[model samples]
Target: MLNHSAGIRPQTRQRVLDAITELGYRPNQAARALVTSRSQVIGVLVATRAAAYGVQKMVYEIEDAAGDAGYRVAIATCLSDDVSVRDAVDRLVAQAVEALVVVGPQAGVFNRLTAHPLAIPFVMVASDRHDDLSVSFDQVEGARIATRHLIELGHTRILHLAGPVGWVEADARMRGYLAELADHGLAPRPVIRCEWTADSGYRAACEVLGTTDVTAVFCSNDQTALGLLHALHESGRRVPQDVSVIGFDDVPDSAHYRPPLTTIRQDFAVAGQRAVGMLLAQLRAAPPPPADPVRPRLVVRDSTAPPG
Candidate 1:
């Protein structure tokens, strides 16, 4: 093919490409980064998996998007709060990440960001408890959908398995749940506070099972729903036949759960994509319009039905 140079030598071009592949030689992103000062890496700072569901999902999605966009994802977790987040950002900076995306920093994290000088662009995945983000999900609306679904099914004594006491987003979601109930002219039923864990859900469900005959339960997250399902079954209550259950986050295992849980599906992957897109726009010194809030869709399966 190299010898056959006529007709623009298509075979020769293929041979050259094959040779490049065989040699394991590739263009250096670093060279382009150094020349343009755009590292082509998106940094993702996230809380531990136990602390934040959305962020965990978002981080993985951001990595996927970055890969598709021809960039890399540099991540740090267990940055429990703002101080740790700042430190993590410094670390990613060392790795030459051109932009940043943070998830679930404690209070003052967003506030502090305003005063901090950033050498590169950054996007916060969720911080509305303190301040509205550059962009994110329509959390309130999602809760509204969850609540409305219950009400439409004639569930008036709807119960809420609220998230841990100080999470702002949790508070917002709870409020939406309550507001939606009140709007239907129904009194707010019992709310069981639980940590974001399957065990917590189990304990909370046991508590609820002991007294209230809640026709329906809205778990704060999927893990809790898993726990609740167990407690309900043990108490001689059949799902959908006795009490309907619903959950948020639609985690990967939700669909595979016993009886196949019904949950609110938020495409954190899409959210992650938006975060990196915003960061890239910032890195390029280009205007990044606000990312449209992601909509949550209720994925109904074996868990929910008319109260029997």
Candidate 2:
């Protein structure tokens, strides 16, 4: 009666439900799993350092979607090293998770995952469509949109403040920036590599201001852009006046920046929902659909304009 199996009379079912409520009985998920071989749990793997706003938003969305579908989510946080990733995977597998979702921005995490394939269905949340089980916001296209906006504003010498070298999103954004520049017949400038932090962005901006002559700059992420904006302000340069600046990941705080930054907005909710749906489908033995990268849109603000 509790399982709601068919063929029970309504009166008997009501009586059993009433009795259960009077007894305050709760179903034991562990005992049920033992009987039915269904853990009804989805595992999520994320890197500790990669827990940015976008990643956290996606994870929240995934959890909500899974709950709506009558499943629980088990999250495992790991460091950005091979050993940590392997251990995380082992931990989730030991939990009898029916499926897995990988949600870190590190390339090394994916490399380790590829080297050690899983026995169960899994989906990777990333910007690259490297496999059928991957879902992402198109990082490359987002960069292109940001760069093209600056180019159309008549800024010819645009500097790219790239993210850490081994990060996947950073590399994709850099590729997009370079590709857009090439399409406009502009020579690519040397990229300044920085960690995905405001401090790193601040230092990189200082370097750029000291050594390079540019009309604009594109940062790999919103935090990096925030640092750059601070550096430019301290250096007595005006945004979109002395130099235009743009960033990626239209984070919640980007709009609150001093200059209200222009940025690329990724649909993290859509990405999360699609990733969960894909994993569910895979678990049901359905054929995987073609992997399509989610497109990002640009949000214009006070930070970018025609180079003065």
Candidate 3:
């Protein structure tokens, strides 16, 4: 046991340090927890159907940041089902994590967590704003930028292949799409909601491509855009010449798509860092001031052009 109040001689401290280093000694976590009443662990809760590139990237950053802060991360992945999030929370609480960084969709989770009020500090990355403990990228603005890009290229009959309902990002993107269309005085087009997968996008695109009066389509994410591209190719349509497409989440592969994909880029790394910083602040009893959201930017590529 090391005592800070009764100072030790410099030589004694060095000897202990040298002996520990030579012995390759490691601290026993159980003993340390008994002394400090802390687990030195941060719990991470992830609940999503589409654990896409952005979510993966963000989780990596969060783990990195937490490690740098002298804390280990305990991850719990939950399904999109009703009771899974609560179960996930229960598991994390059982581990006695000092804080939590929740990523992915947590629709009803806020209420459940609030009602229970786990005394530990937590930061959630999702659609709902939680006073100051929530952090999120601006999905609505990202969608607006994607849609405005198509409109700038003179695409009138634009269709939005949206993400499934009950997702906050999906709702925000849908609202942004509708807002942009309304701003242009264009009648609202019926949105086709699909899972955030290439297969779902392919199926949706195949069903709507030939029948609709659409010359442009804005997909919710890059995977969906990839599927749409494949569908368009099979349907005897030339990208940018006959149809224009835009996507969200400018994923790594988006730039390498056949004609390349025009999409919105969200800085998942920055968002994760910010969320971790906030959680750290909460743990340290100091909350950071409200900051601007991580905004998404549009990257134009060969996939989009003026409708022929």
Candidate 4:
């Protein structure tokens, strides 16, 4: 009766339930798992360096969705290196997680998992699409949207402030910017690489301002844009007048920047829900649905305008 198993009369079950409620009885999950052989746990692996706003939002959404489905989520953090990735996986597997979600942005995590496959179902949340199970927003398209917006505003000498070299998101955004420029027959400028930080962006902007004479800059992320805006302000260059700026990832604080930023908004919540749904379908042996990447939209703000 306590387990809600069938074959128990309603009156007897009600009496037992009333007594249990009066006694404040609780069931032990460990013992239940032993008898039922279902851990009802989903494991998530996130790289310590990749825990940005978007990734954090996705993790929270995944946890909420899993709870609604009667499953608990266990999260583990690891470095991007192979050894750390392996150790994190071991810890999660020890918890008897039925499924896994990999949120690390580095290529090493994928390489390690490919070399040694897990028996359980797993999904990767990445910027680039893979042949295996994965979910991502259309990074390339998002960049194109940002660049196209600048081009449509009549800015031709557009520069790109790229993210760290070799990062999947950085590479994708760069590709999108290049492709859009090529489509427009505009010559590409040299990319200034920087880490995904305001300080890096500030330094890069300070250095590049001496030689580069571009009318607009497309930043890899909003934080980079914020730094660039600060640098431009300090240098007495007005935004959307001397140089227009656009950025990716319409983070919450972007709108509050000195001059509100124009950016691309990624639907992290949708991606999280879809990832969890895919894993549940795999566990049930059901046919996995189409693996379409999430679409991103452009958000126009005060930071971009026609070249002066």
Name the candidate that leads on TM-score: 4
Cα RMSD (Å) between model 1 and the true structure?
4.2
Model 1 lDDT on a 0 to 1 scale: 0.78
Which candidate order results from sorting by lDDT in descending order?
A: 2, 4, 3, 1
Question: RMSD, each candidate, Å?
Answer: 4.2, 1.8, 2.1, 1.7
In terms of lDDT, the best-performing candidate is 2
lDDT (tens digit, per residue) of candidate 3 on 89-176: 8899898899988885646666656677778888888645635778877888888898999888888899999998888888889999
Regions of model 1 farther than 4 Å from truth:
1-36, 49-53, 105-108, 129-133
Model 4 misplaced stretches (Cα beyond 4 Å): 7-25
Residue ranges of candidate 3 with Cα displaced over 4 Å: 1-23
Candidate 4: tens digits of C-alpha lDDT, residues 83-186: 88889999999999999988866655677787888988998887466544888778899999999999999989999999987678888899999999999999
- To one decimal, what is the Cα RMSD in angstroms of model 2 from the true structure? 1.8
Better of 2 and 3 by lDDT: 2
lDDT of each residue in 82-130, candidate 2, tens digit only: 8998999999999999999998677766677879888998888973555
Prediction-by-prediction clash tally: 0, 0, 0, 0
Instruction: List the global CA lDDT of all models.
Output: 0.78, 0.90, 0.86, 0.88
Ranking of all candidate structures by their TM-score, best first: 4, 2, 3, 1
| Root mean square deviation (Cα) for candidate 4 | 1.7
